[model samples]
Target: MGWKAAEKLIRHWKVLRGDNVKKHIKQGPGHEGGIFTVEAPFHASNFQVLDPVTGKPCKIGVKYLEDGTKVRVSRGIGASGSIIPRPEILKMRTTPRPTVAGPKDTPMNLVLEKTYEPKSGKGMPELINILNDVANGLGSSTNL
Candidate 1:
């Protein structure tokens, strides 16, 4: 009995722009990583726009057929045979690159110029020392 609802959903469903607009296509429910073609539902008809001049799957690309109008060329190819499509995005959905916070002076720098490279060439500091130093620096001389 949801005929009206179904019709409304179909009418409002946005057209899949192209492979460029989509990040991933569901390969299959059982497929590994669930990624495949950039196109959704992977339909051949959606990519059937042929170039008007050369006419073999439009390798020449979508062009103005004696009439001027702009459109995305097939495979991102252009009038000049230029490979216009940007190369597939490498490292898709990767975690943000760790920020290289340029040359920041840490809290330890307030007492010593460098934290990692100790003046005494000491190894890692004890947690108690760290707590004591931090407390003393915060205007407290009490030992932890």
Candidate 2:
């Protein structure tokens, strides 16, 4: 086999070995700033999430229990809807988190309407525009 293939094989083997040993991974300060702990090889095969009704692969959604504890539920539609029982197979699974987006979708030009500008001025229009841009968060000092 090529050297690259051999190296890839070695990396895969190491992950498997670590998972086999149940290396603990905790939070705080790694390259990702997570805690230092034992590493475990995680592969989908080891902890499968399947739709109960169709026996097909599915995504899990999280909902809180009546007692306020969190649990995973099947996101599958129709009659396939069901709560996922704690997997008797895998010992651990990370909780799913919602992703968030910022102000990137907001249009900067819309922050100040043209009709609102000073009709005739030497520097008044320019000065007020900059102040309005900063106040409305449409622009910043760094852009200057």
Candidate 3:
């Protein structure tokens, strides 16, 4: 690789490796300095996803199965013919959904309860009364 290419590769490697360095800006804060970790935007080319079945480096490709489900597959040279399972990190949700209802959660019966009448364009009288009470409480608090 040429100097520019090598430099670019090194920069990418540094970012991926989480290389930390003490940097000082000549323009601002000339003397005061601390270790500043590099931010992301690491190139995808810097790493390769290994094939799960063969344990070999391979390029990914999208393929549809007979069941009409689309999945990632190894396609490039020396690729293993196996369906790549999605990484657990990718499958994970930032906030996982609760499997069981909590005490604060509204009961299914309450959620399914018919509260509105399409024919009269009016909500159930009980809900209206509860809403009015809540509004009154807010108004009283603000007045205080």
Candidate 2 positional error at 27, Å: 47
Residue-by-residue lDDT tens digits, candidate 3, 33-56: 455554545565645688988888
Candidate 1 stretches with Cα past 4 Å from truth are 21-30, 38-144
What does candidate 1's lDDT look like per residue over 1-144, in tens digits?
A: 499977765654445545555465446576655434353443334444444444445432444534675444555343334233423583265587655544664454566754464576465576547676886795354543
Clashes found in each candidate (C-alpha, N, C closer than 3 A): 1, 6, 0
lDDT values for all models: 0.50, 0.62, 0.72
Q: What's model 3's overall lDDT?
A: 0.72
The full ranking of all candidates by TM-score, starting with the best, is 3, 2, 1
Off by over 4 Å in 3: 1-14, 18-41, 92-144
For residues 1-144, write the lDDT of model 2, one tens digit per residue: 999987776554424343245433455565343433455655443444777777776777788989998777777444265777775665464664535544675455665545443556543676778888989999989755
Which candidate has the top score in TM-score? 3
Q: Clashing residue pairs in candidate 2, if any?
A: 24-38, 27-35, 28-34, 28-35, 29-33, 29-34
Name every residue pair that clashes in candidate 3: none
Top candidate by lDDT? 3
Candidate 2 lDDT for residue 3: 98
